[model samples]
Target: MSGTTLLINLAGSIALLLWGTHMISSALLRGFGTQLRQWLGQNLTNRWMALACGIGITGVLQSSTAVSLMATSFTAAGTLSLAPALAVMLGANIGSTLVVQLLSFDISIVTPLVLLVGFIVFRLRDDSRFESLGCALIGLGLMLLALRMLGATLGDVEGSAIFQLLMRSLDGELLLALLVATVLAWVCHSSVAVVLLIASLAGAGLLSPSTSMALVLGVNIGGALPSLVNAGSSVARRLPLGNFLVRLSGVLMLLPWVPLLAQPQLLGQLPPALLVVGVHSAFSLVLALLFIGLTAPLAALLTRLLPEPERVVDPGMPLYLDESGLEVANIGLANAAREALRMADMLSSMLSRVLQLLRTSEQANADEVRRIDQSLDLLSAAIRAYLADIGKEGISDQDADRSQEILMFVINLEHAGDILSTSLAQLAARRLRRGEHFSAFELGTLYPLHREVLESLSLAVTVFLREDLPTAHQLVNRKEVVRRLEAMASREHFRTLREDKSAWAESGDIFQRLLRDYRRVHHHIAALAYPALERAGERDINGGLVGDGLADAPDTIDRKEPEQCAS
Candidate 1:
């Protein structure tokens, strides 16, 4: 083959290899992501267990980067401690090499059979699990086929003058080879693919043993870069940074010994393919053994290096929404859900301060409430945009529903915040300007109602997060309690107004307005229950179950309740 044609074929094989790796990673994530995360979270009791868990998970997923991201997110959320998280990263490095070891052998004979079964299983439309498995199988087949094609393509150019010159140059400049391989791995986002490509080059007699070993070390270093760059917070970045440090240290220790280790008496007795993969595998294994016990101290070092930033309140910017997560539906949905919960917390805080504002009419308190409300608005917009950016193509039905559910919850929260900042805050300001306070009786009536609203807010958050049917029932029931309390307070105000018309008129007006706004806020909060109840097969707004005959009828619950409450 001509040099140009050889280059094209080589590039195509490499691209195929990268694409196959992505398919396997994405498919596994879609199929069993929740279980993987839960398992990773539950088993992180100590460093040894965390190490085993990481090895098992990365072996299954065949992508250390995926494991790294998972560990980083857990660390960020405080689900996994820094020490255990470091251990997981160490195991992940070794797990990645295990995949390389398996792929380095001659398994092209099974490629056709794997692809056939994968295609058949993938065509089974009713079972998502089977479909995901099939996709993973197909990805595996493609990777094997690509490796075969790579060997063939390189063999055609193995004797070319230009290829020989390039290989000779890399043999002289080991650092240059390392740099090129590092860029390839970083850009491809798969060290496995890069190492496999190097193994193929070595097997094809296109690269010296030292050059292949140097490339392997480069891939090890490059594998850790993507997670560090994409991490969302300082805490999240630590695991990846620590992993990078470990790999860099290993490479530094081994760089000067490459020629010695690659000699015929040492590692060169094995076949070229085995030599390349053995070095890769042994390097990671040594690192894991050396650093596994030191994970705690390493974690401490990382913590000092990437210390948590002081908690500056940037309320308008989202703290949990991760843009990189949008590439994976599950991760994106998770990010949106976390941000929605944050919005709920902000709403709860605003509600708690509303009563204080009414009592004291303090300008500072009112400003804080307004600021939180503005932050809510910004977060609402950010979440909506983030969810919208998650591409619909390839997302499962469940994830799409979850995305919608989070969007609805945040919208309700934003509406409730508006009631606090706009309607209630203004009433408090009016009372302050007039140099009047709520009467003792008015405060007495309002206090219980405010307390109930706060309780209901808490319940609403619970329902939003858990979607528990019983809790949904209870939240919907609280709506009636809030309504009755508001009515009773209004009646009492009217009675006081009748006794002294001119004396009670202004305060009565403000009191009734406060009750109306509070009830409206409660309405938005209560709206959270309807969707949950509906999902549980309750057809009525009051959380009553109905038969299938009634299921098709227009929703008795106001799907647009939050927007109505806002209006």
Candidate 2:
């Protein structure tokens, strides 16, 4: 074949290899992502277990970059500590080398059978797990086929004068070869692909063993770039940065030894392809052994270097919504949920102060409540935008439902904050302006009702997170308790008004408004239980239909009676 044809064939084969790797990663993540994440999360008690967990996950995912992202997110969320996270990165490096080892052998004979089975399973299966498995098998077949094609294409150009000259020039210029390979790996975003291509070129006599070893070192360094580039917060970036440093250190330590190790006497009977793969494997193994025990110290150093930035005092800015998490559906959903919980917390703060504000009628308390409501508004908008950016592609049906649940929860919290800030705070301020105070009987009735709403807000948060059936039933039950409290308070107010018209008449309207606002706030808090109950196929909670009884309207507080309040 001509030189142009050979280059084109080589490019096509490399592209196919990259595509196959992507197929395996994406398919496995879609099928078993939650399981894998749980496994990784639950096993990080120590360095050894974390190291083993990383190896197993990276091997299954077929891409260390994916594993790196997972580890980074765990650390960023404060779920996993820095030491174990670094150890996982070390194991991920070794796991990637194992993939290269498996592909280095001649397994081309099984390629066709694998492809046939994969196509049948993928096309015929209705189950999503089966489809993901079949898709992964097909990717495996494509990888095998691409490697075979890559070797054959390089073989045809092995005898070309121009190829021979280029190989000869790289033989003496180890640094130049290393630089070239680093660029290739970084641009391709897969060290496995770049290393496989190098092994093929060495197998075809287009690269010397020493030059191939140098390229392998560079590939390791380049593999760490994508995670570093894509990381969002300093906490997220630390793992990738530490992984990069480890690879860079190994390269510097191994660069001088590459030529010595690749000498004919030392290389003995090993084929060039196996020799190149061995160098990659040995480098990773050495790094793992050296750095595994030092992870804690390294983590401390990294913490000092990448100190968490000073937090701004603005409560409006989102703390948990990391933009980088959006690339993974599960991570993005977790981020949105955490932000929703933050909104819930802010609403709780506003509610807790309501009774105090009403009792004291202080301007300071009212101002603080309004400020928290404004913060809730800002956080609600941020979370909505973040969920929208998570998008529909690659997200499972369950995750899409979860995204909606979070959005609904956030909307309700925002509505509750509005009631606290505008209606309740204004009523408190009006009482202060008119020098009106709740009588002993009025405070007695209002205190219990306010307390019930606070306890229900706590239950709402629990129901939102766990979606526990029993908890959902409990939360829905409280809705009835709140209704009875509101009705009793109304009856007592009328009784007081009739018994002493002048003493109660002036403040009676404000007191009644306070009772209605508290009930409305409880309704919004109780709305969280509806989705959980609906999912459990329990349409009725205490004789009330799920998602009924309340207005169910976003941000609207109806002034209707308790009977009409059933949404």
The best candidate by lDDT is 2
User: Tens digits of per-residue lDDT for model 2 on 1-567?
Assistant: 887898788788767766776677678667766565565567786899988877886776556766786678768867578899999989999999887776566656788988898888888869887899889889878866776776677567656787668766888689998887787677656677678778877887778878888888889988898779878988789999999999999899889987888788897258988888888888888999999999999999999999999876778788878654777889999989988988887887787666667667578888899999999999999999999989845688888888888988999989989998999888877887787776667777777777777778888888999998777777777777778778878887898788885764647788888889999999988888888877777786564665544322222222232221121
| Model 1 lDDT tens row, 220-325 | 9888988888888888889899999999999999999998988889887788888888898899989999998899899899999999999887777887775457
> CA RMSD for every model?
11.1, 10.7
Could you tell me which residue pairs clash in candidate 1? Answer: none
CA displacement after TM-score superposition, residue 119 of candidate 2 (Å): 6.4
- How many clashes (backbone N, Cα, C below 3 Å) per candidate? 0, 5
Q: TM per model?
A: 0.58, 0.57
Residue 263's lDDT within candidate 1 is: 88
lDDT of 2: 0.80
Model 1, global lDDT = 0.79
Clashes of 2: 5
